[model samples]
Target: MILVSYFARYREQLNLGGEKLPLDASLNTVDDIRQRLIARGGVWADIFSESNLMCAVNQDLCRLDQAVEDFDEIAFFPPVTGG
Candidate 1:
């Protein structure tokens, strides 16, 4: 399982703070997981529509194609806007 979280505007838009997903699916990378979420339609599509979407794997910066492991803490949020 993977712990997925959303913050800032994304949390409000998705109406969720976080969730857990099974690793049974062939989603080994962040990008793969994103595509699956986009397929869910509604707010998910919007959350993932941007190429600059910020992501963290266990709270560390990570990329879309980055590999993930079970129980990994994955967080998604828009890029920080403050200076």
Candidate 2:
């Protein structure tokens, strides 16, 4: 299983903090996982469709193409800004 988390605005928007997803061969990369979520349509698709969406794997910031493995933790959030 892979742990998936939504933070800040994403958490509020999705009304979720995290979930455990079944790991599968098709979920090879962060992008792959994202695409799968997007395929869910509606809110799932809308939240992930943001071009400026940020992500991390096991707490380390990474690109969407970054490889993913079973039991890894993934986090998604919107870009942050400082005043």
Candidate 3:
């Protein structure tokens, strides 16, 4: 299984903070998951909008196309903001 999380506005817009997906289907990279999720349609598809969101795998920021593995905690969010 893999944990997919959303932060900030993305989270609120999707009415979710995170979820875990079964890994039985096999996935290779972050981009693959992103594509699959977006393809699921509805909230995820709308949120992804494009390949322009930020991603973090296991608490470490990474590119959209980075490699991914089982049980990895992956986070997706729009670029952050600060005061």
What overall lDDT goes with each candidate model? Answer: 0.90, 0.94, 0.85
- Could you give candidate 1's per-residue lDDT for residues 1-83 as a string of tens digits? 99999999999999899999998668889988888899999789877978889999998998898999999988999999777
Each candidate structure's TM-score, on Cα atoms with residue i matched to residue i, is 0.94, 0.96, 0.86
Worst window of 10 by summed lDDT in candidate 3: 22-31
Which has the higher TM-score value, candidate number 2 or candidate number 3?
2
RMSD of 1: 1.0
Candidate 3 Cα outliers beyond 4 Å, as residue runs: none
- Candidates sorted by TM-score, best first: 2, 1, 3
- Alpha-carbon RMSD, each predicted model: 1.0, 0.7, 1.6
Q: After superposition, which runs of candidate 1 have C-alpha atoms over 4 Å from their true positions?
A: none
Q: List the residue pairs that clash in candidate 1.
A: none
